[model samples]
Target: MKKLKFTIEDKKIAELLGRQNFSTRESAIFELLKNCYDSGSKTCDIYIESNCIKIIDSGDGMNQDDIESNWMHVGKSNKGYKNEQNNRVLAGSKGVGRFALARLGNSAKVISKKEKEIAVIWETDWLTSGVKETSVDFSKGTIIEISDLRDIWRWKNVETLITFISRAYKGGDMKIHVHFEGETYNIYPIFEGIKMGENYVSKITMRYDSGKMRLSVTIESDEFRSEVKEIIKPISERYYEDVFDMINEIKKDEVEEPEQYLKELGDFSAELYFYLGRIGIGKEKFMYKHNEINKLDTGVILYRNAFSISSLDGKKDWLDIASRARLSPAAATHRTGNWRVRQNQLFGFVMIDKNKNPMLKDLANRQGLEEDEYYQLFKNIIGFGLSRFERYRQSIIKKIDDKNKIKNKQKENNKNLKHFLNKPTTVTKMSEKELVSLVDEIKDIQREAKEQSQAREESTKQHKYDVRILNVLATQGLRASAIAHELHNKRNSLESGYKNIIEALEEYGFWEELNSDEFTRVAYKNVPQTLERLEEINIKLIAFLDVILNKIEKNKFSQKIKSIKNSLEKIVETWSQQYTWLNFKLNIKNDKIGEFRITNDVLEVIFDNLILNSIQHNELKDKLIIKISVEINGNTINVEYGDNGIGLSKKYVKEPKRILEVHETSRDDGHGLGMWIVNNTLHMYEGEVVEIDGNQGFNMNFNLKG
Candidate 1:
């Protein structure tokens, strides 16, 4: 048999390695930069002109012999001696990285020189022909002049390119300068706008190596200090709780198998900066650009050997962060207000390289990570940290919001009290008792405010201790005042009950008559139909006392229980007795988590308002139906409250969440503070209530631990 060699067509070979390898024009440009860095270049300048793109690098330039051996060789890279590398790792290893020229342009000319040798030139009309080499004028380095442009680099494109360079290349010794039409940009302005946050919520750094993953997290949102923030202390203290509480908080995860993190995968590190409030605070122009960049190029980029992977430059969430954000849209990035640490709120990068993370391979297209086990493990480990950060972020945001709501509610309460005290009306003038009640309420608010100030100075995490009390008391004050004002007609039956008992006794004497026998006679066999009426009045009196205790009493902050079944079932029993005509049903599902970490008082506030709102707004046909379903999974407690009276009101039908706001109500007799209290109190428990749409009734679901 004769030895045969397969002929490879130059055009057919270029077709697969040129534009086909790079997915974006930015990626192509980045590949060329990687070449300069890999060549041990300390300084590189890029000039963008009207006709051509020129890149000049002060690196180990190619000689004529070197060009013929390596530069001309397809499917091969120039590595050996250059990568001895003076402590710098080579970024371009795929050999085909040079075809980036063909991806950006149809023709190119290269001039290179090495010490003590004549400078050489290489020319090619890449689309139509092959390469040619000769002598040239360049000395000590290389200059690549590319023409026949494919994609024009616009202002935004340059800005994006600079961002990638700033993030990826951290070698302080190397210098990169970009020259546009007339403007020159270094690395400063590309990211200075992102540092405008007053005080960042956190800057988390995580590293994986030696079969272990360690995270160094710094939290700095002092503005959110006075809220009930979830810290690592409590979690670390819980014996039954997860050591990795943040990762455990994930409700929906697509990754099923537990990949051994940092086992086969080599060493890598990630740094994430979370900006909660204002980004680019004062620089309006820069803020506009930063926000625009955040829409795409503003996420976690991947860097290999200090050079960025252009396709993974956060324009696409290779981290699957946006997917998690989509799972909880309420707290994700918003167009206007109330944005928490969603996907876009975080800016960061993950560093890896071919020598260390050889298994985490980029596809032949140089776009995505190969869909393999290594990629899955890489994402999973990083995602665990992300999920943990989300919980921490969500905790901080909820507490901040709860604190603000408390302050606003307190201010409104004080304002209303002052209005009533300064401008006394007919009711206050007529009833000294009502005036006294108003004075007591003002004193109570002042006392609670003082307690809050003291509690805040003691410990920010313990602020929830006061939050529980204040939420219950504030809602009670608002709702009680409104109901008391409107209960004039409802008092007639109570007055009649007292009048009947008094009449039966007053017919004789004050001291001689009003005894237990007289009470019993009114309770059992009074004149005609007084017995049934008296029994009903007695039950109403008892129910009234229970209401006073639940809403007006000081919150037992120490009463945090693991099982919500005891507390919730008790609530159902109490409500059944309190509203004798209403049918209250409680269903418990997935009691695996025991119950929840929710306080007893906060639980009452959530369910009470849901049930009360049903009675206040809708007419009862036979008996109002109140159904509560509680399910536990992991550490989260989910509860759905539904009533069979009516669907959502027309005013809040479109946006059912509107009913949870501070002064939103449908009933004339409603306090409007009921649902607001329900919403805010839940936030204190790391919980949130979302209104769900249904056909037959009003339904809302909430989580005790989110």
Candidate 2:
């Protein structure tokens, strides 16, 4: 090759890169900061005055030769071949960073000096007289001063600019200081003071033939810590048009596995930090300035190659957290499900190494990554990680709610007990003997009345609980019957298919051909195998139908006297299988308590309602623990049932009897029928139910006449 030269209009090219490359003034500033960072700058200072803007940095300054060859060139940089400088990876490579100055103002002055070198000054009018060089007094540093501001800079804009600078340059040893008038603010210290309430971290590394992609998510708060890891599948074609469609195109052209399509995209890693607001601490502990944290633009920030991506900065619903919350209100609210975390409650960075993710390139406009297969896959992976965190957070919130409820109940119970035990009395108007006797009588009467009141209250609550159970059982029964009917229909179809197969074989002269040894061997071998599989299916269907029928029949209330233990055990066994996440513990202190006049239906309704309430209302991540203990005292059998779940609210706890009121339920979806059924069933049996204090979950003590 003899020679190759490229020519372009300098003014036009600078304007294109300056105006088209950046979407916002903040991004333009970020580009300038990135240049300083790449120059091995340890400290960068920004000063915004009435006349001009200045960015000064203590970095490895460039000499006249380096400036003439590299700095003056557009679209070509020495950074492409040698990626690292000053023990740090270069953040800029396009040789367009100087356009940031043009984007900011019309005129610019740059003074730079390298160690043991004479200082040089470069002056430029972006529109004409491109650049002129001269001598300066600077020593071993770089200072950029620009005049003629392009846009109005309000106080809010300056605040946002400072925040952007703080978030963009967090890693490494560099320090950024901003000055407005006489006030000076440091970026690092403000960033370090962000207070969080809860945290969850997840790291997943997916391996392929070529390389591996690593994803790290950190959700931090002042109180909790959790982590999870799992492999996620790529998005379906119906969801996004990029990744799946591209893969399908590849398959149409070549014979290859679906996995091969993903393997070609290469590998990369991303780290996301989620800040879930303050916990049990005051606002004074926060590192972020008050105005900065309260800004409307606060959201999850995205970065590529150690610099913030301008398009994704201040984007509210990048992950669609708010829309998801709106769709599922129960999951997003504080008390209901607590499964959603909004965009405002989060701030983090996602870093993708350029060398690894070759396919994941930036768009020409610099708004976001290219809408390619790799980018779609990356979004799906991140969405999966966030979903996992939500589930974990929901469980934690449930536990906290349960603990607080129990604590508050205990405090109330203690206060009431103290009042009852320490009632004041006057003995001035009566003899000592009469006073003592009268006081004893009054105490006995008050105690008896209190016991009766509590018993009535518990009986009402038990009824409400019972009604809910019956409703759940009825719903489940209908579902089971529907399934059984479907199975019955399938069984009939299988029988018909069997008959058709046999008839077809016979009609096709298979029986006549069976006389031949070869035909006979094949028919005997294959026919039995097919028939055996059909028989096995028929057996399973019959067994399943029988189980369903047994449960339905047992639900019919009877006047028979059954062993309480046996009835409870059956109900427990059925519910245990249905809710495998729950732990059922049964303790029978007296084995010879004999039989009681209670039907299986009553027991099923009671047990099912309690178990259902625990499962539905519980917010804890741990398995629900339900304890059942029975003891024979005198002529009555005492039964205690309790669970470690979020108990009833204070209103319901104080007035336990109201729980039995028709249509009264703590849940938004409740029909308010379960507890009503329980109350009526117990009344019919002449049994008594009382709510017991000192137990963590919903505790009930009932006595059945033996």
Candidate 3:
């Protein structure tokens, strides 16, 4: 091999590193802060002067030899290679972090010292030459002064810069301060209450340990009674692949062992604070401030160690949450897809300890992680966690919206009532003759009111009767279907038994011998067993069919008074026979009850629908208990109907009246017309059902005019 040395151009390389290595001045500044952090700095300060910028840190500084070998070297760093730095994991690996100085300005001077050592001063003019070292007496800390400023430091830019530093330094021991003109800015104050917005505040914390990722999320709002907290384990390969494919447009190859891939990413924890916008619940003052901050800064930010990843900052949707929302609008929980917390609605930090995640490396540009399997898997895991948060947020928003809708409806009703009450009434001053005419007018008005009341009552009664009829018809249809199904099964069993008897007779040649003992046995004993079973099935079928036929035959509505007790007893008997699985208990205080104006057919319809609804809706885990207690108090009969089955949900309790609406049911097989019919039927008799307290199952009390 011939001895050959590649000559290098330092000026061109320096310019390239300055312009291409870092994306912006803010990113370059972040790199410098990382260095301070790695050096065990507890405080870092940035001073923006008219002509120059200076960065100072209270960290263990470098010596002459240390500066020459490490600080001056390009593309070579030992910071995160082994992880043995005073029990603190390093944030920088590439030596190019020093090139961040070059990105800032062409000339720079650094003065640094260790405890009980002479300070070393280094000067570098990238526009001209390399670094020069000297000695100086200074405290045990580092000070970097750049004289040639590259970019204009406007007030707005400085404000943004301070915000970036503050976000990066959150939850870290290090504190950063910025000085511009005469004003001083600290990082902590800017980030306070940054997560809360008008309608909602959300917090998500994720911890990774032993190949498992556990995420805990909390959503809170004044609109709701309690905050919701959920802990989730994100470990499914299919979930990761689904989210990954959603963003990348190409499906990633499935990992054979996903747990192993998670292990490789190492232990890390991240906390995300999101503001849900004006629709969220909070004070207007704080909301205004939060909204302003949200406009400038929002995103799922990534931080290694405690320092933020530069390229992942400021409205960068690395998780692609917004895109997912747009793609599936209905799938989004908030009012609009944009209402979902996107990159611009969030501000947070992801903390990763380098010692645990030694393999997690950044790309050369320092924007984000290397596009390797481990990094991709890490992104997918975070995305999965966010997706879950979105879903929870949606549910919370829906609850809030429902409550708001009810409130709005109530307000509207009140407004209408107020308007009606406040309406102007006509008044006229009149003579004695006119006063006499007024008396006559008053009498006519009273008569009209009476007639209106009577008409309204009749209309209500007619509506109730119609509802009852519909409910009866529906219940009968269901019962008929059940009976038909049972009949078919019973007929099959009977036919099979008959076929077996005939086969036996033919096999033994019993039919040929008329008076033989074998023929007698077949004809009498075997044939009778089959016939007895058929008879029993036929009787049960006929009884069930008879109940349906009797109801249909007397379906015509009538005004004939009927005995309340007798009607209830008949309903109980019919239902008990039809639903042999159910247990019915009736406690009628007055067995010989007063006659009701309602007809027998109408009463039967109401009872049948209620019984059928109980059977169809209630969970038949045990012997379903149907209890009916009736007490005749004067002209009104107080009736209580209950069942010992799965009770109604709180939703139904809050709005019991909704249960009576047509086509409203919780059961998948229900026609939703049963309760409507029952309600209407009772209305005809000027009766109403009221929800009653019960330990188990659905219970209701109603009053009927007798």
Candidate 4:
């Protein structure tokens, strides 16, 4: 075989490694800053003049040997390739980044001096620059002067460079100052901006040492007292079970101690700050800081040896946080699309060392980390921390929300009760600010609802009402504000209550909810409260419809006495079949079904309410059995109904008929309306329904007008 050596071309190689390494002009400059960081520089001062750029740093300067062996040598770097020195991990390892000077300018000069030696001057066309000894007075740091710029530099480019570099190094001991147009600006710590940045509502600290990961979050109580809560997940618990098992299968015998596989990731400490809130994100503070935060690129960032790593800035979702949140969202289900603790809501940094995490190396292009097995483990671990923080955040929020909901609901129920009872309510005079503040809070809750839900439409309407209230308060003072509160109550009653019931019943619409005097937008699926809400709204709507029906279309049989042969049986069968799991069985002990001059629909309200009450109140029973006894009096029909349930609610146990009043029962919706509807309809027909309490299950006795 003939011996042959390949020809080497320096200029083409320089172009390939230099200009081809970065995607933008700003990143080319960033590469130079990384050189300063690798050189142990504490402060890098950059100057941008008309067509020239100068970068000077304060650190231990390099000698002729370093310039020849490392800086001048192509494809040879020891910075991140080896171990850490003097408590610093190299921000860069490949020797190719220095050639980036060629990408920025045509000519570049380097001046460097050791603490005890004279200055060394070197110049290059980015391939092979000449070096000479100099007697010029110089400090112990490297200085680079680049001129003959290839592209026009604008102030916008300066701003972009500033933001790019600032996003890299989270405010640290190392400082960067840029001088442009005779103005010098010190880069500020990004996450700790003016208000929202400094005042994060929640913070989570995570550390991995040995083989275990430790996480703690600062939780604030309603009293504003803050305490750290330790989160302990078993080290054996795999965040990526399939990936781990697959890798384990690949390793087979080599992975004798499979549980210790996470140790390959080495150790790291991370601090995550939730900025949108706990720096106590209230409605007022959120509104004040929202615009400022929205303008910044915010996400979890990674740092190596206290220096920001390139390509891991906030602009990139390297951890896949936003997508993960958008996919699952967990407890943030009420808020659509994204989780409350997702990427944009957080400012975070993970500190890893190149020496400890040798495998977590940057890719050949220097754009990002190599997505290897260890890197996947690292990302999975970070995802675990985020999910835990999200859970903790949701738990705290729900606690506070439940407490507030109770208080707000109590006040509202009292107000609604007074309105229904025709009693005077104590309305206090309010200042414009207080009234506006109150309206803002209500709007805030509406805004808190998910956009895809009907709650959002309610939110929009409420917002318009809030704006009108504010406008009226601005003009009319306390008088207008006071009148607004009264209007709010009246509007809710008439619009939400009567209006909703009239539209819902299809066989009539949703006839069940008409019992209550107040209404709310319905839910997505069937719940225990659905039937209760339907009937309250239904009773009134049905009764009102009955009155209207009598006026327009007359039924000759509607006024005549009719025998109630199978009226109660059909209602029982429909409901019993509807809730098959309840295993309802109805027995009629009386031979004669009641006869009445009433319509079958009117008889339905009495038996239907009685049956609905049994189903609502019975939770512990395996099955419900209803026993009925019918009696035909001289001019009226009487019936006794009883069910095997948990019996009536405690308050209604004594005077169960009182449960027939609106908002009287334990059901979350206006359940009393259902019974109240039955009561009123029975009364007009010359029959009344009463409750039998202190009995097993529920018992009610009522009669029909004959």
Overlapping backbone residue pairs in candidate 1 total 0
| Candidate 2 residue lDDT tens string, 1-706 | 7998877676677688886667677778777877777778888888888668899987888788877888887767777522355556666766777888878887888888887787777777765533445565656888899888887776787888887776665555777888887888877622354432223222222222233223333333322322111111221111111111223112212223435545656554444444444332212121211222222244555556666553245663555667755433343212222245566655454555556566677665444677666666655555545654564455454444444445445642333234435663434455676666666666655754664475466445544544455567689878988899778767666557666766787899775565556644775565645666886676666656755766577446555534666767877786666556778899978756454445666666667776776777785536888999988665567778888877775436544655654444666556666665565556466565666542357887876563
Model 3 ranges with Cα > 4 A deviation: 3-6, 81-86, 127-133, 189-200, 213-257, 280-296, 310-313, 331-340, 396-706
True lDDT of residue 510, candidate 2: 79
Worst 10 residues of 2 by lDDT: 235-244
Query: Evaluated with lDDT, which candidate comes out highest?
Result: 3
lDDT for every model? Answer: 0.62, 0.59, 0.63, 0.60
TM-score of each: 0.53, 0.50, 0.51, 0.52
Q: Report the C-alpha lDDT of model 3 over 1-706, residue by residue, as the tens digit.
A: 9999765566567677776788788888878888887888888899988678899998888887788788777777867532355566677787788878878887888888887777877887864444445566556789999877888889988988877666565445777888999888877723455434342345665555534343333333332222211111222211111112112111235344555666666877666666645532232211223332233254666776566663344566666767754433332222222124555566666666656776677778667777677777766666555655665555454444444445445642333223334652322334566556556666655654664575466446544544455567778677886776566556645446656765677799764564456645764565445556776676677666667556655444554644667777877887777667789899888755455455777777777888887888664555788899988877777889888877764435544555665545665456577777677667667687766543478788987785
Q: Give Cα distance to truth, residue 98, candidate 2, Å.
A: 3.6
1-706: candidate 4 lDDT, tens digit per residue:
9999775566777677767776677777877887787777789999988889999987778788877887777778867443245465566777788877877888899899888987788898755568887765566898888899877888998988887777776536568899999999898666555232334544566666634433333332121222211111221111111111222112223234435555666777677666553332333311223322332455667777645664444687787867775444333322111133566676667778777777688766566788867777777666656655564444444344344445555643333324424643322454566556556655655644432254355345434533443355346544544554555455445346545545656357454544433343445344326755765654544443333343233453364424454666666666665565455444444434344355665766577777777777775567778777766766577777777777765544534554654334565443255665676566667676644664676777887565
Candidate 1 Cα outliers beyond 4 Å, as residue runs: 1-6, 80-82, 127-138, 152-170, 188-200, 213-261, 277-297, 310-313, 329-340, 397-706
Clashes of each: 0, 26, 9, 29
TM-score of predicted structure 4? 0.52
- Tell me the TM-score of model 1: 0.53
Which ten contiguous residues of candidate 1 have the minimum total lDDT?
237-246
- lDDT (Cα) of model 4: 0.60
